[model samples]
Target chain A: MQPESLEAPTNRPIYSPVIVNNKSAHHLFICEGYPSREFQIFYSSVDDSKKTLLLVSESDSTIDHDSILVTHSELTAKLTQLLGEMPLSTTIYVLGSEAFIWDVHSVATQAGMVAEQIKMFAPVSGQRRLFCTHCYHITEDVTHSPAVCSGCQRNLLVRDHFSRLHAAYVGVQIDAEDPDDLPLPQELI
Target chain B: MSTDQIKVRVAAVAQVAPMIREFTLTAVTGSLYPFSPGSHVVVEMPGEQKIYRNAYSLLSDSHDASAYRIAVRLQDNSRGGSVFMHQQVKEGDELLISPPANLFIPQWNAQKHILLAAGVGITPFMSYLPEMQRRQADFELHYLFRSKQTGAYQLELAEQLGQRFFSYDSDQAQRCNISELLADRPLGTHIYICGPEGLIKDVQSVAEQLGWPDSVIHFEEFAAPKPGKPFTVELKSTGKTVQVGESESLLEALEEAEVAVPNLCRGGVCGQCATPVAEGEIEHRDNYLSVDEKARQDCVMPCVSRAHSDRLVLDI
Candidate 1:
């Protein structure tokens, strides 16, 4: 039987086309929770006219002559404008918390950009929201090792299975094999 | 278990547009199977050399069993199927067809639905209209065609959809601004489009530009697949090798060699003819497999996909 369940004909399901070492990127748009050493190094080489950076924590504050600090709403609008008419070979670089990176990516894709044309480096990590594959529960922003599913109310061990399409990591029952026993605590994304 | 074949007689034929004829088929038996909207059936018609199986959307109401209706436009480059339906088929002729199967079902979570169609691609959308109206779902149908006279179902659509129907003629050399149509739309707005490949591409490209996720954008392309190079298939179980000609699909070649493969749409759709590949690269000409699946090279839709390598080892 034909089991090639391709949902969209032209659109790829996975987030890819990530910036590679050898590939050339024509335009670059950077979004960050705050400026970092990585940004300083990346900015040192790129021409000012070719890059636009949006820093999201500061309100009505222009931190650097080269960058603008805007809130989340302002960032959304600015990202759309920058991405709408972006020519071919445009690659966007995202840095910040897990939520900030995924949220901006969500917006970028909505505006018709593919993952291959974008890159992400989440530095402000530990913001975890894992969706349970078994119960379909989203354990939102649990900054702990043993996460609990909000829907099914079960102790879950979030796996590294990340679906870029859903922008959420998958969580499975911690006591699947050894029922009534809990595993040792471990760090989670 | 054997798949039962139903016999139906062409009760009526009418020219709905230039070079396009709509045929109504009534079941020879007591009753026909009821189908939901957005469903299609494989029509078996005698062609030049072989039995031509083409999937056609049912234009009649989903609840109707008295008869099933389908429209076929004579393609300039006549495939034996369309050419046969256009020229040889007459009223009162008995024909065989399979029961209906659906691939393009409506989404339940969408706040609104947008249906776009072009040319004879409007057949599937015709089936969606009744169900959408029955569900009382908010929908707008935008249709593009050559002209008022050439566009099938224009007057009927205008009469039925008072203000919801929009039409653009291709003669004016002005096409719908796909970007404008996609921009500034409400959240959770889902769109379904069917038409020529170019228009379909425009819609998908613009939808992506507007940040419309693939979840909200849907399309159905009915164009006959382009012919490809000939290749050989090595069936692992039977130890048989079948030579697939340039014009012959792997599925067709396998059928000719007395190997049975389940297929519904025969179009690179329905995923009914996807066969696993043990070795050799594939010329994946199907829209059914995901990018990951295509990259893995573990499977190929034999209905449309062929082997890029001279010989392919199939799991069968």
Candidate 2:
């Protein structure tokens, strides 16, 4: 087994379909795809007394009166504007795929939001984004270990260690120790 | 003296305010060690009866290490240290000082820094100005003092900070509305406060009541340990007993007995001198320990805490 230090980041987003924070003066929920059941529960769970804004990336038939629709290209610009106008008492919750949520998180952070001011829901899909350590190249939509690096074309062992800056998991060559003693590919949870 | 002590000579002394004396200290030998902004040094004053060590914020430019400047405000209830500095200390006197230790630092990640100071509490923030300006950090300074005669660096700071500077003189009936100042701030705004205990407590309570998180409200209180009844401590490891005097601290008693305890910022703020307790009740005075930790009674900060019972059995 790998050492505890090499385990997944402790701050990795865990999906909790409830509004846990009640103290914030304002809340902003950024929903990425069509509103899933989890998103619906998360959005509706917000206290009616608190000020809230809902921004949905995709146009859907279930759009509510409180939700605003924005294209993927305009999402960053729209978030920047909203964050600029929001007060320090604001808390942001992002619900989307792993990559999409992290993208929005980056935008919020750039707009001067602290880590405590933002929350992330778990990615909707199990697909991972791998960063090749040897070539510093990113391979998207990875599912299993022993995945081929798109840049270096080497078999990689995807480690659970995550980087918030890169928004990806570290992947090192699997056969670096012994090229012939390659382990069988196993799917990641 | 401790191994970390640095010998320095007092180069010059100036009465900056009615009760404040500014001392400029230069290294006795080589160049002084570099320290970050918001750092304080403990000056050891050799009195006839005992050595008085007091922590003072470095008011000099953080980038300059050749000379260190500190201001001392004479307390009405004279702690021997401040009295010694104000009365006995003069130019060309050699004094041993501890290296700089910082407990109050600006949050670099903050988009805007709001510094709140009352009277001599502006010392640490004075060092922060150059560094903050160098980094181009957005910040503002709000100073509250009794009068122009007692407000050290009032004119200098006003001239330096210009539009970002604000002063509230109580003598002139000007007051700082803590709630109004903290209200409606943008996200990622962090506030730092240093002043009297009342001001610190007021700002903290007001910030919390205004829905500001504890992490965003930072403060540094250089509170000297209040004198209490004499007590005794027994070291569990050595079975040695040390008598703690009323005016002195438990940490000083332990040090006198040659039982060294790691310490910094001896004003009871730093947690370095936290000692495990074997037996006896503790009178917690330090701000370092939380309410739950104090209630646990398993540990004591020797720097300020005293024994509630006649004797304390320490796990030293």
Residue B70 alpha-carbon offset, candidate 1, angstroms? 0.7
Per-candidate TM-score, chain A: 0.68, 0.78
How many Å off is the CA of B173 in candidate 2? 2.7
lDDT of 2 by residue, A37-69 (tens): 767777778776564545555455445676667
- Residues B26-62, candidate 1, lDDT per residue (tens digit)? 9997888898778888888877687667788889888
How accurate locally, in lDDT, is each candidate?
0.75, 0.84
Question: What lDDT tens digits, residue by residue, belong to model 1 across residues A1-189?
Answer: 222256523221232333432233344546555567766576556666666666786545554687767787688898777665554335667777665677777877666555555677644667666778887766667676567789987888766555555666777888867777987777653
lDDT score, residue A105, model 1? 78
Model 1 lDDT on a 0 to 1 scale = 0.75
lDDT accuracy of residue A186 in candidate 1: 75
For DockQ, the strongest prediction is: 2
For candidate 1, report its TM-score.
Answer: 0.64
Give per-residue CA lDDT, model 2, range B1-316, as digits (tens). Answer: 4888999999999999888999999999998999999999989888887777788999988999999999998887765888999999999999999999889987887889999998889899989999999999999999988874468999998998899999999989999998899989988788999887888888888876766667788888856777899999999999999999998889877877888898888877879889999999999988889999999998999888999999999997
- Measured by lDDT, the strongest candidate is 2
TM-score of every prediction relative to native: 0.64, 0.90
